[model samples]
Target: MSQTSFQTPTNKIVLSISQLNQQSRNLLEGALSRIWVEGEISNFVRPSSGHMYLTLKDDQSQIRAAMFRGQNQGLSFTPKNGQLVQVRGKVSLYAPRGDYQLIIDHMEEAGEGALRREFEQLKQRLSEQGLFDPAHKKDLPDIPKHIGVITSPTGAAVRDILSVLKRRFPAAKVTLIPVAVQGDKAKTEIVHALDRADNFNQGQELPIELIILGRGGGSLEDLWAFNEEIVAQAIYRCKIPIVSAVGHEIDFTIADFVADLRAPTPSAAAELVSPDQQELQQRIQDFEQFFVSTIQTQLVQQQQKLTWLQKRLKHPGQRLRDHQQRLDELDSRLHNAIQNALQLKKTQLRASHTNLLRVTPTHRITQLKNQQNNLKHRLLLALQNSNQHAQQHISQLAQRMHAISPLATLARGYAIVSDPDKNIIRTSEQLQVGQLIETQLHQGHVVSEVKRIKKK
Candidate 1:
């Protein structure tokens, strides 16, 4: 080889392959530490070490990528060849091959990732508008009398809800408001169903007090209808209390946020709204036992009181017999007392008669009778003598009275004059002309009217 003299630059720095790769990696990480890339996954490999190796590509270009065990462990989905995904990682150069690759920290399916972003954006907007406010939530009825179920007619969700309702509370009437749970028409059908249910309750006596909007477990895309703003608005505007049971426990939707209650599953929604018959039966049994026990206790107490009363009570027949014996004794004593009183009275009467006889004065009574006869005879003679003297005095007085009496004057033809009033008139001056006057004779008097008056 011909020797050619060349001047080396003094300030130039040299680097080895490893050092260059290292520096490139550091610069890449510093620049693109956390970038999000979306592409189709190809040549995916998960070795026994649990680290995943894959090629991220698009129709125009492709890039090498890796996810270590620590980073890939938290991935919600498994990575496979030909699956489209979005990854978040830093750009780094591998030292072994000097190949620049993306170190993925997180990965998700591409469709789901877009859906998730949309979901978050809608959630944020609705939240700001107060659609997801707790204050807007309604209270679920304790025991709904009528329930409306909005779901596909043939889906597992309706079957599960109906089965749970029938088992837990058969009395709760179920009205199936069948609707498409997913697809382009799912949102419109659900909103219409909710409106129908709400309107039906308003116009019905047995109204739908509650509604269950539910579907079986599915991917976020399958459950997208529930996340629609129209469905959420319908749920919010519905007068009936709604329970959202849209997917598995981990899944969430806008309808769930706007609903009065969010149940993890369709079966759980049924359970929440209905009361358990078994618990009610148990309580009724407990009440029945308590009532029976109380009645039994009262009966025992009353029976004990009755027994005590029976022990103390005497027979009426025996009481009446004792009273009759006492009456007989009193009757005998009264009879003896009456007989003794009569005998004593008879003895007193006989003694009184004898004493009366002994004290009588018979001879004095005869002497008094003779003395009364002699006094009577003497009194007769004295009365006869008094009568003779009285008769003689009467004759003398009668003769003297006859000589000076007015009757004798009347017998000699002299009369007394009087006025009409029988008043004596001694002078003619006492009479008035044409007045009636009387003249007295021995046997009769005469009445005459004066013809004339003469003054003396």
Candidate 2:
């Protein structure tokens, strides 16, 4: 029981650097919750995965941040460096680098973002007012002859529009009204230009047909003049149809919605207003060819009718003679038909008379009379032969009877004897002594007594 000692157990807790980092990440993420941050953006990089990597910084501090594609895609405008932004996100540790970072869920521009919000609000308000309704919009002219343009006259937009108009329909004329396309003064210039076009079209013989309102592409601030409420109202009130072709196809302003139609570019608006001359030429040629073909067909049909009429012309006497000949031929055929029919009927009647004579009742009666005479003769001869045969047979029977008669035997001298009882005796043995007997001859009889009987 003497020496007991305590020693440390062999088991020990162990971890690699990666395992330590992962545990730290779990702890840090659990401790820090989601929060809002405001800072100017720097070192902003967008990768092929659509995820944005950036650093949010202030004068003294900075923090690494990430905004995934799904979150960044909701932003209306692209984010850039040095842009002040507000972000809402959760704190997270990027385990590979063992670095702490924030994962953003939402982002919005710090200052100019308010203007974008105001643009959407005004658009919604006017839409509810029905200013942008399709029923309220005027229809563009099918082929406008006199077009009016309201834009910066020296801009590229005017050059492209003029080129398209000349190429498509050189018959059309475009009147350009030069104006400032931006700044606070730009919206006023556009309004006055639209009113002036309206006033000019009222009493003119060849009125302005369509109006094109446009400018080149720019940032939202650069294009803000067209977004003014007064400009939208001016387009709405103009009697002449307006086609708003402002900026690139992707860029939109308030004027685009208020106009009668919106073209993606100024050149496209020109094409819409001008009709193709080549199409009209082809249609005219088709009509000419159709007219010529119809007339020719009618002439040929009339010529054929004239030829038929000439063939049908005839002399009255020749027609009458032809009719008389046909009538004579019909009469001859009718007479021949009647003769042939009468001949057939006579032949049928003679054959019928011969058949009637063969089956007459008088001839049948004569043959019956001959048969009756022949049968009568045969019956008389048969009766005579039968009577003769019956008489001879009766005579022969009488002779036979006469030969077998008892009197015939008596006549031959043979006598018959019997006891007095008249019983005949043919043997002596039949007689008894002292019996009286009688004898008969042909004409007499005798009585005697039996004296004795002899044995023999």
Candidate 3:
């Protein structure tokens, strides 16, 4: 019965426009704040102010996203439409437009595979063009006097490099080629810096022997400018050797492959280009000490040898006296030897005279005649023996001569026919048709002519 009376259904919850907007903003901001979203980028736009506006959407949903100038400036690669990306940001309602959006703090390509694929493609193209060949790489100077640095002027990398160089070798000179290390203009600036550093060799200025290209530690995106193909090519084409120090120990880039050497950090690159001055000084001192000690030792040895030689040296007067004594002894011995030999010869002659007298007849003429007769008989026997031996030798010689002589063969019923002018015979090949010939025989030689030719 109480509901019988008709009344207009009414519910009152009054709110102002600012209050509505505030409530909507609070609800949306509270619900979707500080989120991580993975989606494909679409409708991407980069304004001249260096701000990025884009839509991130999955198959079922979509959201508007914005990366402001401050955040976008730090990015290495330009974000493109349809790129699979992950964004970290807060979801907030744009109060003025009355729309939900994401305020992105960070953005990255979705997976490592995509980045690796691009890397491989670029590497392949460069390799095919001979950019990555070992033969094309320049050799680093063994000792660099002047090293050029291409990096950010105000950075930890430069400081570390300078510290290391100054400590290792204070005398080495370093020149900085300052350039932007990040942002859109970083690659171009790096290329320009390299060119400028390389071209600095003019007139009387000493050319830079080495180059250190480096940057401080950062994420992959933060170091992506060094991975660009153009940067790699520039490094490869540099006539001077380049040491790449792009990031930390674990980081590597295309520049690392193209450079002549790679350092783990900027400090390491500086250390590579210079020798330790303190260590070198210490080594020089050691060598000097060694040399002095060696010289002293050698001098002592030579002095000992000289002392021995002084003791061995004899005075000229004493040497002459010794030679005179030896000569006198030799003269005495020679006189004794000659006297003994004369005595022995006289004794032998006496014995021989006695024997001769005993064998001789008393009459001088008869004895002489008997002696002559004996000598004549012996001489005749000797003469006969000599004649027989000579005959045997002559016969042997004749036999040997007969064996080798062609004349002997011809005497044994053979004749030699030779071409008169050539004096050649062994075969018919020496004769031509109608050629005059000389025939040699044991009896005589006859002139002849070739009437017919027979070869067999």
Instruction: Judging by lDDT against the true structure, name the best candidate.
Output: 1
In candidate 3, which residue ranges exceed 4 Å CA deviation?
Answer: 1-113, 128-130, 134-143, 202-206, 308-314, 317-456
Flag regions of model 1 displaced more than 4 Å. 1-110, 288-456
> What is the C-alpha local distance difference test score of candidate 3?
0.86
lDDT of each: 0.90, 0.89, 0.86
In order, what is each prediction's RMSD in angstroms? Answer: 36.3, 24.6, 24.2
lDDT of 2 by residue, 1-456 (tens): 213333448665556667677778788678766788999999999989999999999999999999999998988778899989999988888877988898999998776675687789889988998879999888878878899999998999999988988888888878998889989899999999999999988888889999999988888888898888989988888999999999999989888999999999898888888888897678789999999999999999999999999999889998999999999999999999999999999999999999888689997889889999999999999999999999999999999999999999999999999887778899988988989999998998888888989887
Span of ten consecutive residues with least summed lDDT in model 2: 1-10
| Residue-by-residue lDDT tens digits, candidate 3, 401-424 | 889899889879899777767476
Task: Give the least accurate 10-residue stretch of model 3, judged by summed lDDT.
Answer: 1-10
After superposition, the stretches of candidate 2 with alpha carbons farther than 4 Å from their true spots are 1-111, 294-456
Ranking by lDDT: 1, 2, 3
**What TM-score goes with each of the models?**
0.44, 0.46, 0.46
Give the C-alpha miss distance for residue 224 in model 1, angstroms.
0.2
